[model samples]
Target: MYTMNRTATTEMEVTSIRLERDLKDRLKDLAGNQGYQALIRDVLWNYVQQKSGDYQPQLSPEEIRASVEATAQTEERCVLTGKLIRPQERMLLGLTKSGEMVPLSVESLAR
Candidate 1:
């Protein structure tokens, strides 16, 4: 999930490595069906970017969704009204009269 900040916005990466003949064939076979090179570049760049960022955990969509859902359930216990908020939405709003409000996505927010 490492996307480049490029203008055109197509995933791109450059690499210098060697693949064995058999592996190359396998890749070619896969390429015909699945853009193998495109995938390889994306995966390789993901590793590179992740490492560059100190190995942040790459959470899947399901994980994020589940986390958000859990937070929403907990938040529901507190009040019956007020729009459900997402973590990103709260972050975008910043702090109110208090200070920096803890950022939470409606699915993930606890309160």
Candidate 2:
């Protein structure tokens, strides 16, 4: 007979995780009856909470605009292919170094 852990009762999708044998054993021991999935979830949740608490405020609109203008004036590259893209060049087609046509955003080019 096979039974799933308690999280299966929720609408969340099921996923598999692969861990080293020793690490798995340690987590299972720490998890006790809760199962390794619950323990891993708790560990990930704590990490996210701790990390998200350190966020900084966004730049002001004027500062953002200035930065974008400065970046646009400077040499820019395609984000995906990292090839140099000139300011006057037709942005959409001329950018891809790999020759794959990808969407290029004006805001992205400014940065």
TM-score of each: 0.33, 0.39
lDDT of 2 at 3: 28
Model 1 lDDT per residue over 1-111, tens place: 344443332543456778888987877786676466655666677667544643333332222222212232232111111234433232212232333233233433333
List clash counts for every candidate, in order. Answer: 8, 0
Q: Could you report the Cα RMSD, in angstroms, for every candidate shown?
A: 14.0, 16.0
Please list all clashing residue pairs in model 2, or write none if there are none. none
| Model 2 residue 54 lDDT score | 28
True-structure lDDT of candidate 1: 0.41
Residue 22, candidate 2: Cα error in Å is 0.9
Winning candidate number (lDDT): 2
Q: What is candidate 2's lDDT per residue for 1-111, written digit by digit as tens? A: 012244554677778888999999999998899788778876776455335552222122222211122223334444333445466543432223333333232444343
Q: Which stretches of candidate 1 lie over 4 Å from their true place?
A: 1-17, 29-34, 54-111
Model 1 residue-pair collision total:
8
